[model samples]
Every structure is written in C-alpha cells, then in structure tokens.
Target: MRICFPVSQEKGWESPVFGHFGSAPAFVIVDTDSGQLEEVTNGDLHHAHGMCQPLKALGGRQVDGVAVGGIGMGALMKLQAQGITVYRAVEGTVKDNLAMLKEGKLPVFSSDWTCAGHGHAGGCAHR
Candidate 1:
C-alpha cells in the first residue's frame, strides 16, 4: 500500500512534501511494502486547495490513504472521489503521526483545516 503525507517540514520523510501540491513544492510517495519513498517534484502537476490539473496527473494510482495538515473542501472531495481516504487537520510531524498510526493511536480526521495554505488557517499541535 502507498500513503501520501502533506508535510510542513522535512524530518525522516522528505523536504519537498512541505511544498504545495499544486503551487507548494512536492509530494512524498511511500511504498509501505518496500519502505521506499519517492518524491514527486512536479509542482506543475499537482493540486492542493482542490482538484485541478495535478490530481488529474495522478492518473489512476490507488492511494491507500492520506494525511494532510490542512486542506479545503475541493481537494477533499476530489480525493474522496478518487477512492482515496482523506484524513484532515491531523497534527504532529510525519514520523510522529506515522507512529501513532501504526499503534492505532491516531484518529481519522474529517474536518477541513490545517497549517493554512488556502483560505483556512491554523495547524501544528503547539498552536
């Protein structure tokens, strides 16, 4: 299974994921089966706030799930439509969150918000 994480900073995961999907920087694709990570750096082929051209660039890749700090309704819907589970407003670093996820300590999110990129604002647990 493959998972996607929208990150604010690079830890053990990546740095480019900190950028916007469409206008940010890049995305990190982790292969759970092999524990290999590939950074997709085509900023011109991604979308953040909503489904535009980037999501289309994803083609039919099946994303087992996703965890994003902040996002809007459009992107949320687009992901859902693609059969990709959407977890929103999640907090903590990518590694921290991944640990919690393994222990089933993290909860699946549904609210539309995060570290603020579009019109929404506020993210980070210390916030």
Candidate 2:
C-alpha cells in the first residue's frame, strides 16, 4: 500500500506528521511493500480556508491512503470520492504510525472527526 503522510519537512521515516492536511508544507509517501519513501511538495499550500484542493495539494500523485492528524470536511470528502481512505494519525513520526497501520490499529477518519474551521486560534483543533 502507498500510504501518504503530510509533514512539515522531510525527515525520512522519522518525520513527524503535520497537524493539518491541507496546509502541510510537504508530504511523505511510503510504499509499504518495500519501505520506499518519496517526498512531495504541497502544491496548494496557500489555498484559502475551506477551499483545499486535495489532489492539487498532493501534486496529483495517487495514494492508497492518507495518514493525517487532522483534515477539513471538504478535503476529506474529496479524497473519499477518489477511493482514498484517510486514517487518523497518532502524535508521532511516520515510522510509528506505519507500524500501527500495519497492525490494523489506525482508525478510519469519519465525518465527525473533521475540522470545523481553520480560523481557530491555533489552526485546526481536531488535531
């Protein structure tokens, strides 16, 4: 499985996951089968609030799943429409979350978990 993780910077497998999906500065994609990692720049990093274009943010790359600490409802729905399953990530590195994912411990992100707004004092509080 190709699992995508939004990150503030590239730190290989040890990179910490960013708090929000749309506004992350970068993304790390891990190929579970071979443990290969690819870094992608967030193409839509400056999109207006509540108008995130998930595919654009991902630079048009296809991923089987996304592991994020938080996500907006619109972006979540857009990703789901593309058959991509979003997973709620723990407060840890990519390596840590990958382990839980392999063990079937990561939970699927539901609508109720979506961020209400990005105008909060410190960004998305859902994280």
Candidate 3:
C-alpha cells in the first residue's frame, strides 16, 4: 500500500505527522511493499479555511491511504470519494504510524471524527 502522511517537513520515516491535512507543508508518501519514500509539497497549502482541495494539496499524486492527525469533513469526504482511505494518525512519527498501519491497528476516519475547524484554544478537538 502506498500510504501518504501529511507532515510539516520531510524527515524520511521520522517525520512527525502534521495536525491538519489541509494546512500541512508537505507530504511523505511511503510505499509499504517496496519501502520507498517520496516527498511532495502541499500544492494548496495557502487556501482559505474549509476550502481545501485534497488532490491539489497532494500534488495530484494517487495514494492508497492517508495517515493524518486531523482532517476536515469536506476533505475527508472528498478523499473517500476518490477511493482513498483516511486513517486517524497516532501521536508519533511516520515510522510509528506505519508500523501500526501494517498491523491493522490504525482506525479509519469517518465523518463523525472529522475536524470541526482550526485555530482553536488547544487544537482540533477530533485530533
């Protein structure tokens, strides 16, 4: 599986997952089968809140799944429609989440778990 992880910066498998999908600075796509890693800059990083174009943010690359800390309803729905499963990322680095994913320990993100908004007192409640 090719899993895409939204990250603030590319640090190979040690990259920490970004809090919000739409606002991530970059993405690290890891090919689970081959252990290859590719970094793609977030193409739509500066879009207004709630106006995230997921494909654009991913630089139009196709991913089998997304492991992210948080995501909005619109973005989550859009990704699902594209046949891309979004998983709720754990609080750790890419390597940590990847292990959980391989063991089927990660939870899939549903509409109920989507982020309400951003810039809250602490962070996104769902995260």
* Displacement of the residue 43 alpha carbon in candidate 2, Å: 0.4
Tell me which residue pairs clash in candidate 1. 19-25, 20-24, 20-25, 70-114
**Candidate 1 local Cα displacement, residue 21, angstroms:** 5.6
- In model 3, the runs with Cα more than 4 Å from the true position are 120-127
Write candidate 1's Cα lDDT for 1-127 as tens digits. Answer: 7877755444446342332334434455567788876655434443433454536434444567766554455556667777777554244555555555667665565543422344334222211
Q: Estimated TM-score per prediction?
A: 0.64, 0.95, 0.94
Q: Model 1: what TM-score?
A: 0.64
Q: In candidate 2, what are the lDDT values of residues 1-127, reduced to their tens digit?
A: 8999999789999999998999889999999998899999999999988899999998899899999999999999999999999999988999999999999999999999999876646578663
TM-score, predicted candidate 3 vs. hidden true structure: 0.94
User: How much is 64 displaced in model 2, in angstroms?
Assistant: 0.4
Ranking by TM-score: 2, 3, 1
lDDT of 3 by residue, 7-34 (tens): 9778988999988899888999999999
Clash number for every model? Answer: 4, 0, 0
Superposed model 1: Cα runs more than 4 Å off:
8-23, 42-54, 57-61, 89-91, 111-127
For model 2 the TM-score comes to: 0.95
Pick the TM-score winner: 2
